[model samples]
Target: MGHRFPAIVVLGWVLAAAALSLLVTPLGTVVERSSTAFLPEDSPTLQGLRVMDTAFGSGDTQSYVFVVITDDDGLGDGERRVYADLVSTLEDEPERVSEVQDYLGQPQARRSMTSKDGQATYLVVGLRSAVGSPASDEDVKWLRSAVEDLDAPPGTEVHVTGDPAMISDLTTAVNEASLKITAVSLFLLVGILWLVYRRVTTVLVSLVTIGVALLCTRGALAWAGEQGLALSTYTDAFVVAITLGAGTDYCVFLISRFREEYGNGLEPLDAVAEAVSRGGVRCSV
Candidate 1:
């Protein structure tokens, strides 16, 4: 009965895809992208954070600083003012900032803070204990803006970079790169499918089937994660690549076999059944 209706088969797939998309779209809310996701749950860093949180009523906060250089002359008058202003700005935000250390003018600390060329020195800003431990995106944005707002002399420059900055930058980079990679992969898939099939209808059908496979795989993974599975953040990209590559290959194989069967004088529906029986066995193996 189903073999007599190929349009019905395609429509069934279309309807299934529509339903799966509804379920997967909302799963985006539960998707997590944190350091804890990448690290072992029993790792020392996680253990240390828990212990610190218990003992201190919150987790430990990190202090970040910049090694500012005014000119080639080394920690001079302008550079010293830049250092002082940085300290003052941080101190003013006592809620977010716990301490500010300026070793620029200190007699004993001056040598350590200054570079060999005497153009650079470090200004440390201690983040408050109750502040975001692994600073949130908003926190990082605020920190950057505050540092950029500081007035500096002609040769002076301020740099706010450390572990927090690096982590924030890494997260941003991963997101952007994943999107570009996915787009490029899809574009290439369509081009390759067209080259292999030649017929526009065949290529379109192949793409539709690949899309359905990806949606179903992502939806299943999202459901598993919701049910307490520890799915990694990288799983999405991995799933997309695997499903599309394998799905397109299978589609091409089956379509080619159907065409061969029809060319050998089988009826349209008979050709489909023959192709499925043959290709399905190969896929199952």
Candidate 2:
């Protein structure tokens, strides 16, 4: 199609990419970052989670995180206020935090959450959103920021971790790595391609093809996810690496084939048709 009506094909792909980024379900939305997400859908834990989400709502599900506060001197009255205040603060954000376990009044629960050294305690925070969902990740980030801003006694330190925190942190890391990997891959591919081709047009063509493939793969995955498929958060980073490597390799082969055909006195369009038709299976392999 590109060889026949290049302008129309280019315009169509441009529109497709724009629509993919703007209109489609975001790539992150369908990616699951939790360990449970890696479990089989029929796993007892996952089944229970689905049942809980369906019956009691995701807010009341078993999706929870811990906020641990510690001090070398132990949790004194001053530190108690910090914990109380932190719970109250999280409680206020109903949209982010669904349930906050307070050990302030429950002596039994307090003992359970308290460290043997009496210097640390943790809160079991039930998220208002499903695990690995965007809503849940946002909730963890907000909770972390809130913990950091709390006024605590000297030698006191606070941290957020556990199931929910793992999902949130891993998701954020995957996203950051995807962007970094893509940028670095582009830089390296451009340098290497330019060195190999020594032609600006050929270099740009290779990159353009790669960019289109990247957009299409992301779009296709998001689309499949909407149809009840889910992928790991790390898939994006892996996809970026494979797409660039394979896409560039395929382009190199096609260009080489075209040069070979055109050198034999074939016309430009004929050369492209010959390259594509003959290179199809081999380019993919």
Instruction: Name the runs in model 2 displaced over 4 angstroms.
Output: 1-42, 48-59, 93-96, 215-239, 281-285
lDDT of 1 by residue, 67-154 (tens): 3545654556766776777777776876676556566456687777677777777765555431122344345567778868777777
Error of 2 at 236 (Å): 5.4
TM-score, predicted candidate 1 vs. hidden true structure: 0.67
List the global CA lDDT of all models.
0.66, 0.78
Clashes of each: 2, 0
* Model 2, position 10: C-alpha lDDT score: 79
For model 2, how big is the CA root-mean-square deviation?
4.7
**TM-score top scorer:** 2
Q: Against the true structure, what is each candidate's TM-score?
A: 0.67, 0.77
